[model samples]
Target: MGNQTEVTEFIILGLSNDPQLQIFLFLVFLLVYLITLLSNLVIMVVIRADPHLHTPMYFFLSHLSFVDICYASTVEPKMLVHFLAEHKTISVNSCIAQMFFILQLATTEIFILSAMAYDRYTAICDPLRYMERMSKEICVQLVSGAWAIGFFHALLNTVFALKLHFCGPSQINHFSCELPPLLQLSCTESLTNQVVLLTSAVIFASSSFLLTLISYIHIISTVLRIHSAEGRRKVFSTCSSHLIVVGLFYLTGFLQYTKPSSVSSVVLDEMFSIQYSILTPMLNPIIYSLKNKEVKTAVGKMFQKFKFLK
Candidate 1:
């Protein structure tokens, strides 16, 4: 902490500088955030109310819905406020807290998605032993482990970030206090922090990504062995939504974080950040629910129950 001047707060330069653009963004994002909340809530409710959705896939999906709500809530409220404020600022502690939650939830989501892939693999490849393999006890443990790993990962990032010193010029280029932007603002030697970030990213993000890929590989190979085109189509439909989600998540995440440090672009980074932070959560529920007829029917049934209750 040599020559470390305490930094009290930081300015958050949000998505847009233009007044018109800010207003436009505010409305768009407000609508998007509301939809995210509503859709995820519906997913949870539909899953819980329908015994047909009590399977491992829907169980995992309900948890995923919970995460999507939490993940979006972590970032969007502050971002929405900033769009309307003249000067957007966050205290150092708050920024670190935001980053921590973001990291925790995002990492948890990655694990959840991988777990979902495993569920799908078991369902597709070993339908005979699906129940024996993915029992209720195992599902609980898998989800619990994902949450635990996310918590520790977030704790690690927050702990290391607290060690950094911020002297002045405390303007963050993007809307959030993400690890990379925080590192850019630090006055201290962040070599160790960078190494830790990179290492954790590789261990957490890379491992989960690889697992998903391998699971998908097995799933595809099994699907290809089916002789009937209709049988293949039916099997593929069950997984298409998940595959789309994985592609979007990994694509945006990799674009944002996996780039070489040598290449830096604030605008591009901000765009990609928008994709992962805001867009993905908003899209996930819609994608999963609309694509899966089971979810749609469940939601419809739920609506009918509400009507009867009324």
Candidate 2:
């Protein structure tokens, strides 16, 4: 902490400057926020209520949905307010707090995804050990480790980001208080900031991506070697949706910040951020519930119970 200046607030450049577009954007985001909350709530409820869903996968699924809800809630409501009002300003403290939660939840999400992949790998590759290995204690340990890692990673990132000197204009180019957008406002020589940001990013983001990749590689190889086409098809469907989600998220995220920030286009930058922040949250629930027969069956059973109670 060199010279802690009195930078009190920052203005967020949300989705649009156009007045007409602002209202429209607000409505869309509001709808998205509501749906995200409801869907995640439903997921958590169903997982908690249903005995058939008391598996490690659904346990992780419930947590994953909860994390996405947390993730979207951290960023989207602020953006929605910016669209609704004139003041898009965030206090320095508010910005720092937002970044901390964002980092914690986002990193937690990565680990959860990787854990799910590992779950899939074991269920497929070592079916017999799936029950033995992913026991209640092991599940608790894995989830605990994910939360601990997220907390520490976010702690380091927030600490490092707080040290940066924001001598330039306090207007962040993006909606949220993310590291990339916040770094754009710093006036000092930001070499160390950049390095630290990149390293933290790789630690949380890349590690999960690499694990997903390796798990999928083994999955595909084993699937291909199966003698029956029906066997291959059946296994493929079980993992395909997750594969799609992991691929889309990691690719967009990697392209967005992994390269030189100076070289990336503002339009592309905004697009990638929006895609990752808004769209991906919506997609997570859909990807799991839509094509998954087990989820669909569970949903139907839930509906039937409600109707009978009425």
Superpose all Cα atoms of candidate 2 onto the true structure and report the RMSD in Å to 1 decimal. Answer: 1.9
Best by TM-score: 1
- Give every collision pair in model 1: none
How would you encode candidate 2's per-residue C-alpha lDDT over 42-122 as one tens digit per residue?
878888888999999899899889888888999898898899778889988899899888778877877888888988998
Off by over 4 Å in 1: 1-5
- Off by more than 4 A, model 2: 1-5
Residues 1-310 of candidate 1 have per-residue lDDT tens digits of: 5566788999998877898999999999999999999999999989998999999999999999999999999999999999999989999999999999999998999999999999999999999999999999999999999999999988997899999889877999998888899999998899888888888877899989999999999999999999999999999999999999988888877656667677868888888888888899989999998899999999989999899999
**What is every candidate's alpha-carbon RMSD to the true fold?**
1.3, 1.9
lDDT of each: 0.91, 0.83
Clash pairs, candidate 2, are none
**Distance (Å) between predicted and true CA of 252, model 1?**
1.3
